[model samples]
Target: MAATEQPISYAQDIKPLFREGDRESMSAAFDLWSYDDVVQNSDAILGKLRDGTMPCDGAWPEEQVDLFQRWVDAGMPA
Candidate 1:
């Protein structure tokens, strides 16, 4: 049997990436709380991730980053 394919969900996958309290802090510049917010700002998101400018810390683990890229490549689905 073939492996099941799971669609990435914003509420399930993406939203968890951001810290709860900090979500509002970045809202002034970028809103990452919803599907539209991520889709609209995907370029900045991916670019920042690639350049290691996001997370205000450092690069996320390779697996997590890959997951994010996969979500992006999958059209930033909700």
Candidate 2:
């Protein structure tokens, strides 16, 4: 977790986990477009978090993980 990182904005919650260049994780990867287009498809990003496929290499903490799931379940707020 970075010093100023937010809890679970897609940018804050998910991007830091994987190789952004790849959008893949220890569990699985999204489509090619997902990796390339995170800004427009935050739900896809949240899908990864909701299913607990993120925080790879243990980069994210439980609270952030909770936030990720909540954000997704809440319809991925803008």
What is residue 42's positional error in candidate 1, in angstroms?
A: 0.7
Query: Top TM-score: which candidate number?
Result: 1
Each prediction's whole-model lDDT (CA)? 0.75, 0.51
lDDT for 27 (candidate 1): 86
Show the colliding residue pairs in model 2: none
The segments of candidate 2 whose C-alpha lies over 4 angstroms from its true place after superposition are 1-28, 31-56
How does model 2 score by TM-score? 0.37
Q: Candidate 1, which segments miss by more than 4 Å at Cα?
A: 1-4
Error of 2 at 72 (Å): 1.7
What are the per-residue Cα lDDT tens digits for candidate 2 across 1-78?
Answer: 544544445555455544544544332534433434554555665666556565444345567656656655655434
Give the local distance difference test score of model 2.
0.51
Which residue pairs collide in model 1, if any?
A: none
